[model samples]
Target chain A: MSIPRWAWVPFGVALALLAVPILGLLVRAPWTRLPELLTSERALDALGLSLASCVVSTLLVLIIGTPTALVLARSTGRWTGWVRTLVTVPMVLPPVVAGLALLTTLGRRGLLGQHLSVVGIEIGFTTAAVVVAQTFVALPFLVVSLEGAIRTAGGDYERAAAHLGASPTRTFLTVTMPVLAPAVASGTALAFARALGEFGATLTFAGSLQGVTRTLPLEIYLLRETDTDLALALAVVLLAVAAVIVGLSQRLRGAHG
Target chain B: MTQRLALLVAGAALILPLAACSPAPDGPTVFAASSLSGVLPGIEPEASYSFDGSSGLVDQIAGGAPADVFASADQRTMERAVSEGLIDGEPRMFATNHLVLIVAKDNPAGVTGFDASLDGVKLVVCATEVPCGAATQRLAEANGLTLMPVSEETKVADVLGKVVSGEADAGLVYATDAAGSDAVEAIDVPGAEDDPNTYWVAVVKGAAHAEAARAYVDSLVGEWGDDLQHFGFGPPL
Candidate 1:
């Protein structure tokens, strides 16, 4: 696994590019005020909201996305391409555009939202809207990751269980799911982390209120205007959380391999 | 082959900074608040513009963003820059804007100005970090009303968008912004004139085109005053 000598230069440059920003965050962080900043009411509210919404969104992603992954992995029809493309759309679309799409689809006067509002139900600028936006953006991570894992795990064990007098659902529950569990865990972790870092779409679709829709990223952004020290401290907290999630996901991936 | 690849990478590294440092050929780079995004280009079509929330612009300028001139929607933001010595000289007041309550064209919530009809309505306003938000707060206080906004958007434009989209029953945005958009109808806020936000312009401390920056600021106060008034900005008091 010896790396080419010429590649080292470009690789070194890439590593430096990634390392410098993290180093900058570490260096510029207000270490002295971090304790007070994180303990502040604003910080706590945002932190709690971020964790709750992210958890709810991740659960929603797992419940729906796992079946979607299974179907995509098994299907061979031409429409599968379209379905996969639709699933991956949020991953490529700008976060703000994803937010706008969500807004237009579920806003008070949005496509279906206009009808919903007639029934006195509105999704826009609510905590539920925050979850919807997060789920929209985070769905692809779980679906894509689990789809690849399902494809790699293949149909052998499922076929064996089916032949041994097991029902399709029973085979999936007993054999298929266990085999893909590690991948699912990693994917869920990745999706949860993505939801945790969601800012633009949530801001656009859900709007920002202290305890309602302002997640840590949105709080950090608003604070940057009024208090850079608090912003930096919160950013350090977000960075640490993201780092831990990424590490855990990587370990899950290693376990899967 | 490897040598050629290494040389190509080295050449790219050398050229990238030069590419970034290349100035806009015809005009100075102007950083103005998001509220001015609509009219600033119309007023000074030649200058390259970076439009954002004024407080965000202040942070960027402080962080060494490549800005030649800076125009803020309020005095407080400009004063912060002045206090931090980010400006080359004292910023001059160029224009003024006051908060206007905007609603969907049909006014679904039956919002008529800032009256009791606003009670229990899904109202939005700019976050207090930006200028319009500050004025909204002042207007609310001056009139002795406690506004309960459903959301506090960082950009006034977002506030307007929410109202236009009918996600919000009403929003507080700049008078000029309301005037610029046809999607929403503006309702005058009582005593808004008393809490008007003044626009301030200044050249950055080490602007690449310092003379052009100063000229732009001069024109905003001088020739562009009429244009500002036309676009719903009040003449500087």
Candidate 2:
């Protein structure tokens, strides 16, 4: 495809806008102290928590969100638009507001939480709350991406499989899922990345306790107050992890195709 | 399609510069500590405000935020600002506050006070990085008390919030903060009176609204002293 000359100007500006801040970070990052910073107990704890919680949240999102996307993609109901809008609210909401919403719904004194606590079930300020907060914000990305893919893939193959005497579940597992594998992989990657970077909601809902609730981003925020050098080093580590996730996902998509 | 693309490009061209070049606001932008969130607006409603942990505000000012005035919750933070040459002159002590133990209304946790009974309770406090947190440590040490908090929040407001929201049994926060919120009941911390946190205010070094900024600081320590008191702040030390 031949590129328009005028379009190049805006494209270059967009590239610079993204690249410059990263360059600033790289330039300011304490390269000499990175290894020491990364290996510190606090850094290791935050990194471990970020990875563990993101993995759990991504799995939870897949289990819950896949059905949601499928239902939205296949539904012909009048309320489908509204349902999808509600599902996507977290994506557009300021993460802080999303945290507040979670608190109001599930905190100890929250509407649902009040009832749950009566049975000795508590979610607030726990590791479980961190997972919940992460899953809440990450679910929309998977649902939105997979829904579009399901719509684009259509139901022709699934119908043929059903006509051939394949059960609905079997058709879904074989015909429907195989065709949507690329979308699922990309969506999972996006959800995982979003979970990894989640901060405000997690802090607001789960609270920041080292090794229990504070993820890498929250650690970076706290460290920035007391230790800027360590904070910058941890940010560079997070940037690298995000880049690797993206690169590996792109490769996985190409391989599937 | 071409017309739409042209319109988009023109729109970007028009808005980009305006976004990049933020003109000075009508009034001074007072960067204040989060402990003053409730009272600063009432004290000088004419000026704009940005409230956060004093350390965070200092970082922002150092990183080139266009703050006209800086109000800190403790002497140490204001000293750091002055030491970094972020201030125009000596910061004035405007108000003083001490630590207090706050609990959910009616003392749901049945915490008697800042004593041994607080053990095993869900206590929250400010992190040692911020002003309120530093005062919390000092007060605890002076009283020879050891506290094991469930969470160490970045802002005094967050500490107060955890108590207000019923997520925590107790939180250590400023007297002014506990006094301002009707959702919680305040209990005095022993030795808090001996180590009160002093609030300081000063104009920023290179503020765009330098004159307005100075006037605002002057009024806060002068005529607005009583207003601070009305909002639960103690008189300047």
Candidate 3:
């Protein structure tokens, strides 16, 4: 079937808007110095911290978000809508606002934080805060994606397994989980990418300390103030990582289909 | 359906040009450092302002962001802009600021003074890239103390925020920031008085509103001294 000519105008405009900046970045990136820049001590530290924290946060999203997604998908109640909205709040909030919210609730003088400080346990400005901020921003992506998948998969298979004398836990582990593996993988990838790119919230809530909370995005931002070439190089690295993850996830989904 | 589409297109065409027009009747847009957050806006209530780290502002101006005037927290950044041909003329000194050790109003950690003993204390300071952070490093060196900070924020306001929030026991911020916040109390660092952080202001090269930009700079140089003083900034050297 031939597509309408007017539709091509808007589609082309959208494609150009998205592709221009990416093409600009590619053209301006310092390809020769990329290796040296990526291996710099500060760059390595930020990359290491970003990788470690994002991994931890992705794992956290998988564990906590999976159960939450399951509940949201299976349950039917007025309160469930509110719960789902609350879970997705961070996804919609500006990262800086999310950071401020986290700070007010978890900082030393924060409501619960002040009480916790009495026991001499502090989480602000630490690596742990980085994980918390990343998880806060990334959890919604995992929950929303997985919940949609769970709803699509439905309960017929689980019901059949239960009718066959399989326990609910066993059925979930063998039947439901296997069926949802592709969704879980795609959700995990999306959450991992989101966590890796987290900047404002981590900088505001966790504070940018080398070897602790300064992730690659923060490092790129700091470098942008001083060295554009190095910043562009680091940005290319982030873009490459994101592209790889997205390509892999698409391939996985395609294979499943 | 076509009528609605035409109306929508017409509305967007009208609004797009309006958005592209210059900033409203407020005088020329001034990109000033965050340290001038309090005084710049108050002095030039009619002028538009963008306050952020001096280096970040320099980067923005260098990348061709449109601004009539640029006010930097340190001379080095202004000089850099001048060297890069981003500034119209020689940047002039406008105001100076001194570093101070600020603790939460309650002084929970009971920080006594600027000493090496602060190594054990939880402190926050601006990252070395920012003007405040660079000044902090000079002060630390002048005093011969190796300070270990729990966090190095990108901006002085963030450092002040951490201290005010009691997340950090102490922070090194401008005296002006300390003066503005009752939530934090300033502790005088002895040698900090010697290494002052001077501010610079200049008109941007090829500014769209050159007359307004020069007038804005003149206003800052002429009668804003008292305003700066009111904001806890030191007189221009």
Q: Against the true structure, whose TM-score is highest?
A: 1
lDDT of 1 by residue, B30-84 (tens): 9998878877898789899999878888888998888999999888889998998
DockQ of each: 0.45, 0.36, 0.36
User: What would the per-residue lDDT of candidate 2 be over residues A82-196, giving only the tens digit for each residue?
Assistant: 9999999999999999999999999889999999989989887788999999999999999998899898887888999999999978998899898998889988998998999
| Cα lDDT of model 1 by residue, A84-200, tens digit | 999998988899999899889899878999999899999887899999999999999999999999999878888989999999889888899999989999999999999999988
Per-candidate local distance difference test: 0.88, 0.88, 0.86
Q: Sort every candidate by lDDT, greatest first.
A: 1, 2, 3
Model 2's DockQ score: 0.36
The residue-by-residue lDDT of candidate 3 on B1-237, one tens digit each, is 575455445544443464366555558989998878888777888888888888888878888777899999888888889889998988888888899999888787778888865777789998887677888898888889898898888778888988887788899999999989999989999888778988889999998889999999988887645688888888888
In candidate 2, residue B50 scores what lDDT?
Answer: 94
Best by DockQ: 1
Model 1 docking tier (incorrect/acceptable/medium/high): acceptable
Which whole-number lDDT from 0 to 100 does residue B155 have in model 3?
Answer: 74
> Candidate 2, which CAPRI tier?
acceptable
User: Residue B173 of candidate 1: its Cα lDDT?
Assistant: 85
- Displacement of residue A15 (Cα, Å) in model 2 is 2.2
Better of 1 and 2 by TM-score: 1
Cα DockQ of the candidate 1 complex: 0.45
